[model samples]
Target: MDKIKGIAHKYGNNINTDIITPGKYMELSIEEMAKHAMEGVDPEFYSKVKEGDILVAENNFGSGSSRETAPQALKQAGIAIIIAKSYARIFYRNAINIGLAALELKEAEEILDRDELEVDMQAGTIFNLTQGKTYRFTPLPDRLLTMLEAGGLVAQLEQS
Candidate 1:
């Protein structure tokens, strides 16, 4: 995939799925549910974040429930990708299945809120333009890359 350039919305550890999209909004469509995303943590998250923005967080992002809606809500909310120190394994797969790229970088905490970033998902490279620095993470496997490039497993299967 091409490098994604965007402003980062940085956060701390343990950002669970519930905080991502509360269960109360489960009945709503992804579009409507996205408006409530991160409301529990940041009331202005949906408003302040623009399309193609990158979400940066510390360890255990998506630590709560295993609902697919959480990642769906994020994708609907215009998060191009997520960068975290670590992720709940299920959350990682769900994100990929939902077409949201979630990357792991131990130095994720160093990325500041609103900092400009350019990410090469396939190469696992992150460039913090605002800081004039670059960081790397383990690249995704080829099969996963294919799914992500096709915009999720469903799209990939359809293409086949």
Candidate 2:
């Protein structure tokens, strides 16, 4: 399993895929779309995120459209993991298909923006590895954790 660490970007309810990667930018290259990624929600999103950063948000993450490009943009923008209260069905699958980690947690909003978090994919736990220590998330399922360990669903299926 991979251990990922990053600064959190806390968002509230109903964060759709469109906000994740706007439809207008769909025709653009992945690299281009990544530059404008999440621009709708946070104007400084792309600039704020660095390589290996994580996105920690609230309920209904990946709602709306079923474009795989949404997760692709995040991956291209260097997001290794996304922790949220829940995920839309298609977004969750697409994320895993592309080797991005999508973890479900009940208290994701408790994590503040820029909060340093360490995500242990194998252990399925998120720890506020920062000094403030404000938030922590419950472990993911063992089955899902195993898939993450294998580097997402495709790889997991290949292995099997």
Which tens-of-lDDT digit does each residue in 1-160 have in candidate 2?
6678888777888889889899999999999999988888898888888898888888889999999999989989988899888888999999887778888888786788888888776666677876445344566677877776787788889999
My TM-score estimates for the predictions, one after another, are 0.98, 0.86
- Indicate the worst ten consecutive residues by lDDT in candidate 1: 119-128
Query: Least accurate stretch of 10 residues (summed lDDT) in model 2?
Result: 131-140
RMSD of each: 0.7, 2.3
Q: Estimate the overall C-alpha local distance difference test score of candidate 2.
A: 0.83
lDDT over C-alpha atoms for residue 71 of model 2: 91
Instruction: Please give, for residues 84-158, the per-residue lDDT of candidate 1 as tens digits.
Output: 999998899999997899998999999999999999977889999999999999999989988999999999999
What overall lDDT goes with each candidate model? 0.94, 0.83
**Model 1 lDDT at residue 10:** 95
Clashing pairs in 2: none
What lDDT score goes with residue 148 in model 2?
67
